[model samples]
Target chain A: MNILIKITYDGTNFHGFQLQPDERTVEGELNKGLAKTLNKEVKIFYAGRTDRGVHALGQYANFYSDTTIDIGNLPKVINFNLPEDVSVVDAKYVPEDFHARYDARLKKYRYVVHLSRYRNALLLNKAYEYPYKVDPDRMRKALSYLIGEHDFNSFMGKGAVVKDSIRTIDKIDVIEEGDFLYLDFVAKSFLKNMIRIVTGTALEIGRGQREIEYMKEALKMKKRKAAGPTAPACGLYLVDVKY
Target chain B: MNILIKITYDGTNFHGFQLQPDERTVEGELNKGLAKTLNKEVKIFYAGRTDRGVHALGQYANFYSDTTIDIGNLPKVINFNLPEDVSVVDAKYVPEDFHARYDARLKKYRYVVHLSRYRNALLLNKAYEYPYKVDPDRMRKALSYLIGEHDFNSFMGKGAVVKDSIRTIDKIDVIEEGDFLYLDFVAKSFLKNMIRIVTGTALEIGRGQREIEYMKEALKMKKRKAAGPTAPACGLYLVDVKY
Candidate 1:
């Protein structure tokens, strides 16, 4: 049977979501925990991969398991085997051939920026502290240029190798709550580090370091150097995946 | 000159807010950082001492310092000396003798209880996971019995030394947001572990383990065992102190 599971992780101690030989990654931990709970070596497919130090509140995965454990108690039993930084929050039986990656329709990501003068210890590895003054309205204008379908080569991370750079952005929103600015991005998919690079560019415009039109010019140039620096991975969160 | 500083800490690693002979503590870190910044040994007067694993978002402290560093840059310079789990967010000049503990008019504390069946990794040491069903309305009914001035010996923590057990409670609010329940306690002061005990007892009523009138009976009993168990320190937060 194919079992679908919803997962959440802190991601501070994880190398990334992919399986590596020796690093502590989210996928590696999930595999270990699921194998222990199911009493067999397990292979899992995830909805998408999140980079190192990027959190997830609603990451999804699917695996084939013939265990006798009830679906209602699967999350709890699997949680007992998982570490404190990761957990299987929910589980259900899906179609025998269901795939977590191929069946996803849309993905939502959130990036948080703290606009405080002093660093908050509670948010040490949780948020990016940008001390400079910024106007969210300026960022919204810059972000408008990146909406819709485009080849986001300039926004892609340096080492990412993708055959196609064209992707559709469903929506982009800039929201202000307290001293933190939240940037939400929705798309069917994204190139590696695309959202982080977009965030960095929008922040530059928000702080008056660059004009809003720079985003359009950078996208047109289609070169990595044309975009701003990549934002830190600590501020990013995979908010949800729509199936 | 006396300087007042606002502090924030994650509180996951420290032994508590008090200075100990051989333990990592918030006060110890503050003294160490202040001494490093001022080039002299220092002692600080804090608003109140929080127990181990209890966070603080708006803790206050005062100390005498004649450092040459400007007050505007004091927090930043001091933060450079402190560890990653503690930070000084603000600093200012105060009167010659302003005590953080004595002149305080009110204190506000917040306790978070997660009602979700699965534990959240992002809130591992930040909230309490009950995993059981609870009704906020039932908890609120029990909390109302705790309002007003009372001799709260039943709610006091073990090994606390104090001359009086009487404290005045200004308000008690149980707020429900998302899958988490927030209990806000306001008072001139509180007995040690008072809020935690109240929360534990209220949760019992919320989960139908005890009657709503149990709170009034427990308060009148004036015995330690009359109240419920103390909630975990990780679930508590010193929200603010008002003078």
Candidate 2:
């Protein structure tokens, strides 16, 4: 039987989401947690691999197990065995053929920026600090150009070797709450460091370092150096993955 | 001229707020930043010292310098020279007699708790995570008993050696927003670990491990062991100091 699990974790303690042989990773920790709880070895497949120092709020994974454990108690037991920074929120039976990665329909990500002069210890890892005064109106205008389907090769990180860089952006929004500014994006899938690169370009525009027309040139250039610097990984979060 | 500067820092990167030999502290960094910007030596007096791993949002300090740098520009220049996690928010000229510590009126602190199954990587150094269900109503009831004047000897840490353990608590409030719970305390002064001890006791009451009556008993007992464990230092923040 296949089981679906919803999990959240602090990415700072692990190497990344993908499992590595000798290094600590989110997947390795999850497997260790499951093996302890189920008293058997388990192989799980995750929806996507997050980079080092990245976080997730509603990440999905699937595992195959011959024995049945009480689904309601899984969250409690997994949390009991896992470290303080990782937890299983929910567990449920899914279709035998269900795939966590292939079946995903859409994904949502949010990037947080703290615009205040003072730094917040609580937000140290969760938000990026942009000390310069940003023109929100100019950022909004630049964001308007990013909405819709486009070839995002210029925004892709050097490690991304995908053959096709075309992806549809469902929405792009800039919102300010108190001293925090959130940049929300929805897409079917993302290239490596795509969100961070987009954030960097937006910040450049907001700081009056670039113009909206530069985005068009960058997209057409299809070169990694044509865009702004990749924003820090601490400020990005995988908020949800729809399947 | 003498100036009082309101500063904020994310303490994860520093040893603490006090200056010590062979250690990276907030004061040491501040002095380095001021010296680089002002091109001379400077002395600063702080309202209080925070321990390692503790944070501050509104830490008060007074500095004396002979430079003609405008007070308004001090925050900008100091922040530009300082590290990303440390910042100067406000700088104002004050009388030479003004003292940051002795002349202070009130201080406010905030303890943040993330009560969720999943750990947030971004909030690892800023919030305490507890998987157990918390009864907010019960916590509120227990916190109310802590408001006003009382001898907080039981709530003080073992290292605290004060002539008097009595202090006045102006207000104590427990508020929940989204998945975060914050305990805000306003007081004229506090003994070491007083806030952490109070928070742990309140948490016990919320979890049904202790009753509200236990709070009264603990206060009367005036024994440190009678209270709950001291909450971790990472979750506490010096939020404001008003004079």
Quote each prediction's TM-score.
0.99, 0.85
Interface RMSD per candidate: 0.6, 3.7
Per-residue lDDT of model 1, residues A1-243, tens digit only: 999999999999999999999999999999899988999988898999999999999999999988989999999999999999998888999998889999999999999999998999999989999988998998998899889999999999989978989999999999999989999999999999999999999999999999889999999999999999899999999999998
Which number leads on TM-score? 1
On residues B1-243, what C-alpha lDDT tens digit does candidate 1 reach at each position?
999999999989999999998999999999889888999998899899999999999899999988889998899999999999999889999898799999788999999999988998988999999998998898888888778889999999989999999999999988889999999999989998899999999999999999989999999999999999899999999988997
Instruction: Provide the lDDT at B185 for model 2.
Output: 92
lDDT of 2: 0.86
lDDT for each residue of candidate 2 in B1-243, tens digit (9 for 90 to 100)? 888988888888788899999999999999999999999878888888887888999999998888788776778888778887788888998898998998889999999998976555446678887767899999988888778888989999987768999999999889999888999999988899899899999888888999978888888888898888888888999998988
TM-score between model 2 and native: 0.85
Candidates in order have lDDT scores of 0.93, 0.86
Classify candidate 2 by CAPRI docking class. Answer: acceptable
